[model samples]
Target: MRDNGAIAVFGATGQQGGAVVDALLARRARVRALVRTPESDRAQALAARGVELAAVRIDDPASTVAALEAVDAFYFMTPEADNLEEVEEEVRVGAALVDAAAAARVPHVVFNSVFGADRFTGVPHHDSKHRIEEHLKKSGLRATMVRPAAFMENFATVMAPSLEDGTIVVRMPLPDDVPLKMVSIKDIGRVAAALLLGTADVPGGAVEVVGDEPTGPRIAAAFGAHAGLPSRYEALPLSVLRNDLDEAMFRQFAESSESPADLAAVKAVEPDVLDLAGWIRSTGWTAPADRARS
Candidate 1:
């Protein structure tokens, strides 16, 4: 934001981080992307875009400090992993990154958190980030927290497979009248960049990002309209998602997917936020012809 020096970005190879890196580059900001493998294709691609790739392990304090050297600011987001050990690694690495940033005396830090991380939602993932936010607040670093709602990308990863049979099965019955808060990953990047660049009114304040709140039928209608298939929604109880998601997350989906973000404020920051239908049409998502093959 200050345009003083280069900014270091963690997880630059992943979705959220990549979007931030791209946005920063668009603003002509000097960016250094932290990654484990500098030779990886994604990392190399970032390097090709004029980003300085710093090959460093986040858990190692010394490596992290080196990565932050001469960095004027930082952008951080915790990485999610699959198993218990990997999950512990995420916390460890995230804490180490925070400590390293503090020790380096970086002037500004923008932290990516979940929309409902302000308090305990009984969801482990959501609550875990709240803890991280607390640590960041006390780390003596000037930080801005950017909390984003449920990602629209989940349509492809979590729901599209079920659509192969021309029927999408939802774990929780999302009534047509109910609303669910959803945001595009690109919009998340835009908001974060705005905060870091000091373009928004509340630069250091907590900002919740959400694009739209649509019901199950509305979502199915959007997908069906684009895919040209007779797709329908079949909502079950929250119990069906237990095996795949944490129990806490299941409760949120079954009860309320509507986020507590201020839509007007978020829209003010990123005016062109995409809605469900626009996002679906842009991705060219289609119905699968055969469920077995899909």
Candidate 2:
């Protein structure tokens, strides 16, 4: 079991933060979840599972500072934004939280940044996180950044494959051979928990949390094999997305293959991190036929 002091988490009700809380609890670490509504169902469930609840609003950093005061480490991620305007608001909120953490004198921090955020990809949300990263660097507080790769969960939603002409097809604004680094939500948590508890450290004080590096064809093949069906990947044009932010993100997906993830580095921290095939199997990701049956 990993040894960790008390931890306070912002965005605890969301995907990344919630995963961190789960990983911390699995390690028997004390967790305080900062939520805007203590009485919400999700917060109540977390509370029932032994997570301490602290009410906080991003507009009021004082509430964050108060919740953070007694914690040994703090984990936080900015809220997801839909467009450039919301992206600006994300920067503001992140800056405020960084200032709050400084004021509270939190010993350590773990920022849930995106993979390639350090690069000026010009994707609005990615740039937003990088701006926060810049603020954290200037804050003078010790911080470890866990940069998450493409969420494996996306396949269950927007990235889901379609059955056309009796063939399963996964289409994305990516070329067939360009590699994409992917990670399960659980591994993101495990990696962050390791950093927060001092059980693991990255040489640069930042690590891109990644597991599998699969090309588009490989991704489709993995799903196909898992579902016992033949599948193919169709490379779609960026214009098909019709959203500037998403188009930029997919463009980066192609560009980033030049510098792929170091899988060994992540495995050193969390040995059981799932590969793409394993993740597909673990999710029991269904083909179109199976979903129709359900």
Candidate 3:
């Protein structure tokens, strides 16, 4: 462990938190993962990696504060809420965590927020995180917002392509040529780790992190090239999601080409940051043929 002290991270078993822990480990920082279920398999997995696990419940400030005691820094991110009701719950949970960090007197906090969260884009989930950002700001604790753009990993999940008639088709509720700002989950962790470790200089104590801006066709081509298959892009209607919150979010996505995250600026901090093609290759993302078989 480095002499700076242990860094405590909330949501440590999840994707964002897991990535943060990995980055901190790579930098030789001692990591304390605050989890609700210390007995969970995920928690055990982290513990196996030498991560110190502390049980915490967001509703119990005492538990959270105890988990944060003596940590050099705290890093956290809220779970996504798909409805207005869940959004309010997210705000409540986020505020509680922020309050706990303050009570513990952690010197610095790094919040993994979403890009455009500060803009009040009318997306319930994004706005919910912005509310947490507000709570963090008012808590009077030194804090930094490492706002990551859309996850490049989403292409492997929500935006994964479909195979039909021997061709791979990528679909989104977006125009084919409209670029979507993206950052790898790993990069998000790297940026947050830098802030928590005081290794990165971010103007205004916040940065919108993005590594690539790729349109649907470009996304399809990358997958196609990897698999040696033909590819195409399909623009789907927002109504297909059947969720008002998602529809509203996608509507804002239509304007994502104008995101504040500068690729050059992000790369300046994380030189090994991957673009779409690089992510595909590094992740070993294959075409739909392999996906379907899996």
Candidate 4:
């Protein structure tokens, strides 16, 4: 069993934070999940699982500081929004939490950052995390930033509807040979839990989390195989997506950055980290033939 300590988890209702809370609990760590609504069904579920609940305004750093007084460790994850301004606000709040943790003398901090954040300055969200990272480093806090690769859940997010209709539109402007580093959000939580529980440490002071690296067509094939649909990836220019802000950013990523993640290293830390195929099966997203017929 992992050592016991009170760990404050931000974004507890969301995917990443929820996974972290579950992982921490599995290792018998005391978890204090910060939620906007303690009455929320998800929050209630976490409480039922023996997770302590703390209400705090995630956008307010001062509030986080007050709530984190009882926690020995902190896991901070910025919530994503459709608006760029909201994202910027979250970044500021994340940095504040880091400073707050420092003041509180939290022993360890596990920050969920994006892969290529330190290297790619063009991606606004990625750069924001890097700025927070700089602040954490300057604070002299014992922190481990987990820079996760592109989420495999994203394929479902952008392509689910299109895949249901048969063709998976690949908006990424990358060649077939160029691999996209992808990891399951659950795997991200697993890695973070290991760090927080003292089960593992990033030798280089940071972890680039990746479960698998697959090309666009390969992702399409996996989805097709799981869904039992005759789906194919149709690589199109940014114009096809009508220059959507998110798609444009992804295009910039394809042009400027390379998705380099050490999957072997990640696997060594958490052997249960799911590969693409394993994730596909676990999610149970495969539509039955009868459902597809409709």
Against the true structure, what is each candidate's TM-score?
0.88, 0.95, 0.95, 0.87
Tens-digit lDDT string for candidate 2 (150-192): 9998988888887666567889888888988899998999999
Per-residue lDDT, model 1, residue 2, is: 41
Q: Which candidate's lDDT is highest?
A: 2
Superposition error at 143 for model 3 (Å): 1.0
Q: Ten residues in a row with the worst lDDT in model 4?
A: 161-170
Residue 130, candidate 2: C-alpha displacement in angstroms? 0.9
- For candidate 1, the per-residue lDDT at 287 reads 67
Candidate 4: give the clashing pairs: none
lDDT sort, best first:
2, 3, 4, 1
**Global lDDT of each model?**
0.76, 0.88, 0.87, 0.77
Prediction RMSDs, each to the true structure: 2.8, 2.3, 2.2, 3.1
By TM-score rank, best first, the candidates go 2, 3, 1, 4
TM-score of 3: 0.95
Range of the 10 consecutive residues with the lowest summed lDDT in candidate 3? 285-294
- List model 4 lDDT by residue over 38-98, tens digit each: 9999999999999999888756667777878857788989877355786688678787788
Candidate 1 worst ten-residue window by lDDT: 167-176
Clashing pairs in 3: none
